[model samples]
Target: MGERRGRRGREGSAVGLEKYWASDPMDVLRVRQDFVLADVDTGSAPGFEGKKREAEKSLAVGAGILAGLQEQLFAGHQMGDDPRRILLVLQAMDTAGKGGIVKHVMSAVDPQGVQLATFKKPTEEELAHDFLWRIRKEVPEPGMIGVFDRSHYEDVLIGRVRELAPPEEIERRYDAINEFEAELAASGTTIIKVMLHISMDEQRSRLLKRLERRDKHWKFNPGDIDERMLAPKYREAYQVVFDRTTTPYAPWYVVPADHKWYARLAVQHLLIDALEGMKLDWPLADYDIEEQKARLATG
Candidate 1:
């Protein structure tokens, strides 16, 4: 049955999934309503048993597929079709490897087709508007992939942990986010929300390394230590996030990021899955191909 389906099935079909069951690691890492972050082993790669070298090779191949799919998406939009776009939202505790994901996984695709936005502390001007105002501006254009390093989720994560917003307001933001994401999904955006979960011990070691190296010092922030102290609060807040916002349209994937290589590979597969689901085809040529060929031959 698998072999027969392989010859006729789409990339994301059940048959395809069964064929690649051993390779695709996301099946174990995806966040469902009952997902408990504390129960997840941060040091282990759940479904992937491969080492660093194997993961690297897999990433190279996945990158090529991603690039081709992105091009098709772009071409479809250029042809004035209802092209779909991707929005990858990366949310993680400090040093859980968000930057690494962008550097290793995203670097494999066409930079021109990617719309990356790293949200920082809101400016006074931005503060005046809704929290999503800045986020709305950075959403991927038709046929593009948009990545948010830390997205509107910050309002809930940090706001809840730091008491930045009132308890009632923070509660309201969850419903607001669901509505916002539903709008994006309705408009043909495939939203992939990932939370890179790393161990507190792992984070401490990384921070220590950053402080020890002069070159890495710029990346270090004292505020990170402050945040680290509130790890429990942050975890609670994330649990709330997963409960409230992991909608059918935009589910969260809690990736075990202690192994950077595996995290990168898992993310690559997620992207491949999303693109394959798009089932994009090369745009048809508007001009007459035979006529163009004849004209060229005559010339």
Candidate 2:
């Protein structure tokens, strides 16, 4: 994201939206082919100059815009068979704030039009089928925005990192993923895949805070420490995944997650941009307003 800020809607939101963003997050955060995972400054909010206070107010304004667009997406389905929808795939290591993104950002949209799925370790039933089988069942339907906390890419990431699958098998899954995503794009799902990149040191600090607070104890896991030992391996795996799966149909964006406010705001911009691209509008009333009013008066 060193010089990637697009800033398309910085002055104002999409035509009908009455909000504005300081800058475009996607242009700032979208991963390019030359991106190296190791070089990303997890602590830096690259291309963004806004401070926390400005970000908070901007986030609120963005939520209003998101609500309007999401409502139109719902209306599209309610009144017609509009197939447009959004699928936001989030991937990051533990304590990287995937839940925070959902809680703070997506909360702007109507629950009725949003779908949330968290993919943890596979269950017995999930293991019985292809990795995507369980995933396909959870995809957002018409006019819905679906969020995947951790997704099918786990098969390549942890699977490769832990040697859960043989190298050859792991290699095949990447191609399968690309095809699956292409199909989703063709079917009217706008895909936004993001990797919340946080520094190892930041993660350690957050983990310590969790351990210090009894109320946050449930969020911490000893297994996370085990994973930390394998940071080098995990990073290599992620870089490979970025290389293979990112396509025009399903691109990847990596967000710097050291600043919670910045991460949330960056994601807000990504979602807002995706929704804006669809040009959503309220479905027109099919019945005549005058006729309905006259009939109601006579009755």
lDDT of every model, 2 decimals: 0.85, 0.86
* Best candidate according to TM-score: 2
Total clashing pairs in model 1 = 0
Span of 10 residues, lowest total lDDT, candidate 2: 1-10
- The positional error of residue 127 in candidate 2, measured at the CA in angstroms, is 0.5
TM-score versus the correct structure, for each prediction: 0.91, 0.92
Alpha-carbon runs more than 4 Å astray in model 1 = 1-23, 293-299
Model 2 per-residue lDDT tens digits across residues 1-299 = 10122233445543322223434677778888888888888887765666787778878877877787788888998887799899999999999999999999999888999899999999999998988999999999998999999999999999999998889999999999999999999999999999998998999999999999999999999999999889899999999999998898899999999999889988888887897788777787878999999999999
Best prediction by lDDT: 2
